[model samples]
Target: MSTDLDYLQTVLPAPSARLAGKVVLVSGGGSSGPGWSIGKACCVTLARHGASVCVLDANLDAARDALCAVKALGAQGIALQADVADAAAMERAVQAVMSAYGRIDILQANAGIGKVGGPEDIALADWERIQKVNVDSLLIASRLILPIMSKQGHGSIITVSSVAGMRYLGYPHLAYNVTKAAIIHFARMIAQQYAEQGIRANTVVPGLIDTPRVRNTVAKMFSADDFEQAKAARDRQVPMGRMGTPWEVANAVAFLASDEAAYITGTELVVDGGLIGKYV
Candidate 1:
């Protein structure tokens, strides 16, 4: 039987099966477009490291696509459809995973949405949607998964936040910042509350990552009719002289989700290449 263990050993030449035998549930674990996304990349990386992953996304087709990618890479995976913003949908999704996998070891809450509006232009509805997607979904996923982890005596929970949570980078989005900040604080609190129960929680704060979902839309926000100009401007803001990639963010997540970070919790891992170093 060539398990994910065999695949990892032969394929990557890596020294360890970091997540061997673990089951990971990743919400938003699919690409919104044809390219790599933080969620999709994280899911694949976890699979590569020997984790059996459940790829959940609001889009069923995207979820299936991501699962197929994992399978193609010789990893175990399944597809699930859930709108993270919806409580019932998230609850049902969690139930589906429990029914299929019987237990959850790692969960990466990566579903989030950004609205392009400042305080004055922000609509109450859009703000609520952002809260539901970014903040509420995290809470819901934790509530549903923590119990199983608590019973099993161990688990890791990871939340994907943003550098915008700390500082604005000429972007005028109020809800995104607020919700992202909320995710970090909430994750810290969860970490403290569950640390005694053998459960760990952490947040990944990414800075200026070049991903398909946010680039063009953010370009519009910065009044860059030219997307390349937006990319260039963002590159200049990073100390590395370039914006980070989705894989970088995903790798951070993969590490956190693994036993490698067993003693780490309640902290924010900043994946920014010195953006906050200069600004904050």
Candidate 2:
């Protein structure tokens, strides 16, 4: 018999060896709960397509779990523990990957936090924490990897920014909104600065994703005892009448990480299920 976990861990089919011989380092590369997560999906999807994936997360065990999926795809895998919010830890993580795999070809920055509150309701500490998790972490990863990529003269950086960053989408979390917005511009600037170095940087903006982390956060934000109610409310907000799946976002990450996007850089890929279209 198959369990939900079994279903969630199913390997995505390879689309050929597009990423063969490439090394991919994914930060926050694990699931937050017993279901598909954006980070895990990205790692697995990239691995399925032939990339050797390095799974880095604060939770070493979870990182290992995702590493298993990477290997299941007949891909090489490595697991590393790192607190992305800590600059020193991230630097060490970059070094560790370089030690294990001579060079990194793809950098996936996917770790983030979501807190619900507006300016008046948010506290200084909460705002700072959110910024560190959502914004500073991306900065740390990019700073550490830029020089390495420059020396190699080839690399792709795919960051997971939220659609909330582009505009408000029925959430009151000012900190999450502001920090996510920062991730977009930060990635774009990196793309522009590193274009001559044969490096590419882009942001994947996800909206109303149906992941465990998102479910719990929405429940808390609306004070809804019934998670279903909160979920349906989120569904209604999207023009497509439903929230997106992790696999959908993974597709975007894989495209950017692959050579298919060699000429694509400094652009925003909106995986919002038409939510942003409705907003516009």
Which candidate has the highest lDDT of all? 2
Off by over 4 Å in 1: 1-16, 218-225
**Alpha-carbon shift of residue 78 in model 1 (angstroms):** 0.8
Question: How many steric clashes does model 2 contain?
Answer: 0
lDDT of 1 by residue, 1-280 (tens): 1124343344332424798888999999987777667888787788878888999999998888778767876778789999987778888888888888788999999988988789899999999989999998887888788999999999999999999998987869799999999999999999999999999999999998877787656655576456677678779989999988777887898889888899999999999998988875
| Backbone collision tally, model 1 | 0
| Candidate 2, run of 10 with poorest lDDT | 1-10
- For every model in order, what is the number of clashing pairs? 0, 0
* Residue pairs that clash (backbone atoms under 3 angstroms), model 2: none
**Per-model TM against the reference:** 0.91, 0.93
| Per-residue accuracy of model 2 over 72-96 as CA lDDT, tens digit each | 6668989999989999999888898
Cα displacement (angstroms), candidate 2, residue 179, comes to 0.8
Error of 1 at 228 (Å): 2.1
lDDT for each of the candidates? 0.85, 0.86
